[model samples]
Structure formats: C-alpha cells, structure tokens
Target: MWFFSIAGVGVIGVLIGGVCLMAQRKSLFGVLLSMEVFTLGVYVVIFSMVWFLSGLNSICLVFLAFGVCEAALGLSVLVSLVRSTGSDYVGSLVLGHF
Candidate 1:
C-alpha cells in the first residue's frame, strides 16, 4: 500500500512536470515551479517510506533541510523575476538572455 501511494505521487509529479514543460517551453519560472512541486512530492514519498521502513530519526532532518533550501531558492528566483519584470506572467518576457 505504501509503495503504491509513493508510486502514485511520483507519477503525478512527473505528469505535472511534463505538462508544465510542454505548455511553457523552457520557461524558467514554470520549470522552477514544476520542479518545486515535483521535489515536494518526492520528499513526502521518501519521508513516508523512511518512516515506514525504519521509523523516524535524525536522518529525516536532512530531507527537511533540503526542502527548505529548495523552497528558498525557488522563492528567491520568483522575487527576482517579479522585481525585474514587475509581473509574474511568464508570457510577458521573451526567451533567451535576460
């Protein structure tokens, strides 16, 4: 059951990433957001697996730290994009060197 749940989450994350990639076409913000979502899903799945297999311990702290860093970097990029473009709409910016 746990294995199935993890598999389902992984599949969903992959689908979301693929769709986002297709729609946005190498968009940095889109790719970042998709990656964040994928990362969160993977983290949850991994944590659950860890807990189920070995019970919780200090090792989980590593996952927590990674998630925090990923979120922080994502947010920083978002803020930079907003500040530079004055908007969050990806369509407004053209592809290529910014």
Candidate 2:
C-alpha cells in the first residue's frame, strides 16, 4: 500500500513536469490522455488508503469503474468534438460547449 502511494506520487510529479515542458497537449486527445494518467494516480492513492484502513475492496473497485467510465466518456467526447469541429482542439472543450 505504501509502495503504491509513493509510486503514484512520484510518477504524477514526473508526468506534470514532462507535460509542462512538452506543451504538446494542446488537443483534447492529449488532454484526455493526461487526465487518465492523473486518474490512475488517484486510483493508486485511493487503493492505498483503503488497504491501510482495512476497508472493503469494493471502494477500490468502484473507483476503478469510475476511471473506466471517465476514459470512455472522454473518448466519446473527443470523437464527437472532432466530428463537429474537424479537430480535437482543447480550447473547444473549454469554450462553453458544455
């Protein structure tokens, strides 16, 4: 559990730094991919919490389910956005389309 938490934090930090330097995630697809990586870190932390607390594994499972759903939703939105705008620009998602 502790290992997972530490690994999650470390990887997330690296990811953030890489993302900041790359500046290549100017599209919705790249944004969603980053979000999924972030979600994975969250899942690891949550799993560690549940493990130490002696709680039910259901909590971890539920979070995993949500992550899956988020990935699916992101992909669908990306596809639709591309179809409508002919591009997967991140700006479109933030321009009050919601």
Candidate 3:
C-alpha cells in the first residue's frame, strides 16, 4: 500500500536522524544538522497524514514555518556560542566555563 511505503520512508528518516544525532555530538553544527534531519522526519510523518486527509493539509505548512523559525534561532545561538568561545565543539561549552 502507498500508505505503508510512505510511512516507512518517514520512519527511515527518523531512524537516520536519531543515529546522526547520537553519532555527531562533537560540534554544535553537527547537532543542529541532526536536529534538522529529525525535524524533517517529523515533517514527513505529518505530511503523510495530510496526504490521507485533505482538509488538514494546511497543518503541514504551519509545521514547515515553525521548523524554519527554529532553524534560524538555532543558527543564531550557534553563532553566538562560537563567537563567545571561538569554537563550536560541545566540550567548549562545559558548565564551568559559564
């Protein structure tokens, strides 16, 4: 069924995102990228739901807008962190450094 196939794709996205999030913890950029992947996975899942329901399709756009906003905010934070410490490494942001 097309439904199952689409859902499977979404699940794969989620799995890859999770793996990337876990494996790419070295830098803030990596983490942010992984989070984007994870968000995209969720968006795929939501879009699949929209595919089945015609009336609720607008929700997908709302999610996309929010995702963009989140990404922009995340990039700003990463820039700030890197500017303050001169490095994007997670270890550079240890608690004692504050």
Candidate 4:
C-alpha cells in the first residue's frame, strides 16, 4: 500500500534523472545535477527499505555523507573544467584540455 506508493515515487525520480542525463541540451552542471538526482533516488529506495525492514541506522548516515562528498567532488571538477574551457558545454570539451 504505502510502501508501493513510496517505491513508485523513488522509481519515478530515477527515471526523471535518467532522462535528464540523456538530454542533449544540457550543460556540465546540468549533468552533474542529474547525476545527483539519480543518486538521491537510489538513496530514497535504500533508506525506505532499510527503515521498513528494521530501524534507521548509521548506514543511512554513511550514505548521506557519501552523497555529499560525491556532490562536492563533482562540483570541484566542474569548476576546474569551466576555468580551463571558459564554458560548461560538454560537447565542446576535449580530452587534451585536461
């Protein structure tokens, strides 16, 4: 009942993120945001399952910490890329620039 509804929302989130990632008109930051959304979807599914199966635990905290670190690292890369290229368009990026 409620579980199915919640899971459906999580799945929808994942699908939306996937669509965003596949979009052609996206900037580098947009791609990173999409990836973050995908990660968030995964977190939602895992957190819901764990919470339902037992009680909330330290594992949830670890997952959150990882998500934060991933976002930070990704943004750092994006910043460097923008600084070097003066643009955030993925298509314009060249391997030699790095």
Candidate with maximal lDDT: 3
Pick the TM-score winner: 3
Clashes of each: 0, 0, 0, 0
Candidate 1 lDDT over 18-48, as tens digits, reads 6776677545677777777777667666766
- Model 4 agreement with the true structure over 1-98: per-residue lDDT tens digits: 67777777778889999999898474989989998898888788777888778876788889989999999999999999889989888878878976
How do all the candidates rank in terms of TM-score, highest first? 3, 4, 2, 1
lDDT against true structure, model 2 = 0.74
Arranged by lDDT with the best first, the candidates are 3, 4, 2, 1
Per-residue accuracy of model 3 over 23-72 as CA lDDT, tens digit each? 98679899899989989988998898789665687899999999999999
lDDT pick, better of 2 and 3: 3
Which residue segments of model 4 deviate by more than 4 Å?
24-26
lDDT of candidate 2 over 1-98, digit per residue (tens): 56665766847755774574366556877777667767776776677677677789898888899989999998999889888787887665656654
Model 3 global lDDT (CA atoms, 0 to 1): 0.88
Worst 10 residues of 3 by lDDT: 89-98
User: Residue 86 deviation, candidate 4, in Å?
Assistant: 0.7
How far in Å is the alpha carbon of 19 misplaced in model 1?
3.9
lDDT, each prediction: 0.72, 0.74, 0.88, 0.85
The TM-score of candidate 1 is: 0.63
